[model samples]
Target: MKLQDSVIAITGGGQGLGRAMAEYLAARGARLALIDLVPEKLEAAAEACKAAGGDARAYTCNVAREADVEATFASIIEDFGQLNGVINNAGILRDGLMIKARDGEISKRMTLAEWQAVIDVNMTGVFLCGREAATKMIENGDKGVIINISSISRAGNMGQSNYSAAKAGVAALVPVWAKELSRYGIRAMGIAPGFIETEMTASMKPEALEKMSAGIPLKRMGKPEEIASAAAFIIENDYMSGRMIEVDGALRL
Candidate 1:
């Protein structure tokens, strides 16, 4: 679809990859409904979008909650008059080894709560928002695109049983949703990012960052804008659906 005049809703648009995408899409002339947990951050992003010459608004939402997602969409429809697309970009990280033992005795294992928390936001949150957006698209009878933000961790990473499982589910959901939604003229896709230099990675120790980058064949971490660029491409290109575009710089990790 054309970026100009398109109504695009983004979850977690306050910061990180979400914020970057909001800025990019806004610059391209899309009207935005940016949803995030932090109202202040959303406000800040809204200001930036305005500065970039785009029509934009912000909504504070906990994407993992059904009430919040539904309410946010209601507000979006009220404000934008129509909803054409969505980016399920809200996610969280809670990493831990599933099993840790010394001398064969189990010393540590991932807690169910830890596992559930990540899954709730990363996996289930995607489902809720994607479903809501698809329904709206169908109801409006508008051709739409839904982009789910998956991660390279979906390939199975150490010390991230919860995150890995959740991400893997996200990747799987892309194809399933594509099949189901195709009949309605809606498309679903996923982006599995690898080693992006965002706030989370910046917090890691310098040596640790070096060690991680060493694994990437390009010897570098990806930028949020890189992922945003990929997203823009997917949304504009109608033939691309049920696919997971890896944004990693040849990084196995």
Candidate 2:
């Protein structure tokens, strides 16, 4: 499980916590296969990883697509000569209540499109990528790790029926994969982060962000690097699997 020279594929590597993980793991001498829907962002992340003194390549991919996930992993194995790990990090937020009420009357409801979009990327995407990664590792007889990025909202949050459901599904996949894939020498785990300071959260209004942070015991937001550190620990610790490590600064939502 050593990272040095190991090949790891990361989805959503274009920016945010995924990019931070790419940089951090790269600095530890891991080779990177950075995947994202945006070519520009993928290339930028690859360059950043290279600057951090790791061999890295960018693959433009939509993780939610079966063809894209399969093709991307094939490319990674071809380029790196092996697949050692994968991070299911690609996700999108389409937050809305199941039903919005105004004056005690139903006004708007969460659309099927919003719910399906989030499920496609955040849940199905993880399944596709994790399946491909496990297939490769098992075929090659390589012991590897899979990390899924979950959220505090997995506990369920108001105004986020879609997001919460998707994230909770992501967390549930961990133990199932761990038990199913362990015999093949693949370990599955999850990281559920609280309100981290990333582009996604930075978009919140200043007052809203402040109020959110005040609710956390730390009274502050977590940095992306902190989550990256947890990822590193999971990568190096072979015994860790089938469980989720919450990196939410003791925040329960």
Candidate 3:
């Protein structure tokens, strides 16, 4: 539970919330094995973690591909000796209306590519990493934690049919996995974050961002460190499992 000298593998640890989480845990003396598609970003993150006084390494991986994930985990285990926890934080957004007409009129009908792409990374990627992490934890007979990064959109967002469905499915699996893995001393949990001030949202129009902020009770976007703090809390609180914490500033979205 304590991050000090524990091994943790974080997917998409290059930027945004994942990067922040990596830094926070690393500062607590957690050894890190970070995976990301962008080598440049990963380099920056790795440097930051090392500067924070932790052992850290980076690997390029595509979580959507099981082969890639398996190989990357193998490399990580080889390098770190063993892992105490894993953070399934890798995700991508392909936001669009399920259906868009030639005139750009959006509808409820989603395209196969739109659905599959999001599902491939957001859903399937989580599944692959969680499975691999659980297997390792169980096989090693070591108590560990598995944290799945979910989203506020899981409850349902108008243009996020694919993202919403995938996230919802992920949240639904938390309890099931926790019950199944509890015997092995492996805890499962989910974190649903609201509008966070990450690179992904930096492109939003100021007016749109303001409108979104107004919808939240706190009236502003959250910081990546806020979510990272929640991650640290969950990992340290041994009894907190099979549940989700929403770090969305009281925003329903």
Record all residue pairs in model 3 with backbone atoms less than 3 Å apart, i.e. clashing. Answer: none
- Model 1 gets an lDDT of 0.90
lDDT of model 2 at residue 189? 94
Candidate models: Cα lDDT each: 0.90, 0.93, 0.89
lDDT of 3 by residue, 1-253 (tens): 8889888899999988888999998998898989899999999999999999888999999999999988988887778778788899988777887676666765456679878999999989999999988887777666889899999899999889889999998898789889999999999999999999998789889999999899899989999999999998998999999999999998873
Candidate 1 Cα misplacement greater than 4 A, ranges: none
Cα TM-score of candidate 1: 0.97
* Order of candidate numbers by TM-score, starting with the best: 2, 1, 3
Candidate 2 runs further than 4 Å off: none
Q: Using Cα atoms with residue i matched to residue i, what is each candidate's TM-score against the true structure?
A: 0.97, 0.98, 0.95
Question: Which is better, 2 or 3, measured by lDDT?
Answer: 2
Worst 10 residues of 2 by lDDT: 244-253
Worst 10-residue stretch by lDDT in candidate 3? 100-109
- How would you encode candidate 1's per-residue C-alpha lDDT over 14-51 as one tens digit per residue? 99889899999889998889999999999999988878
Better of 2 and 3 by TM-score: 2
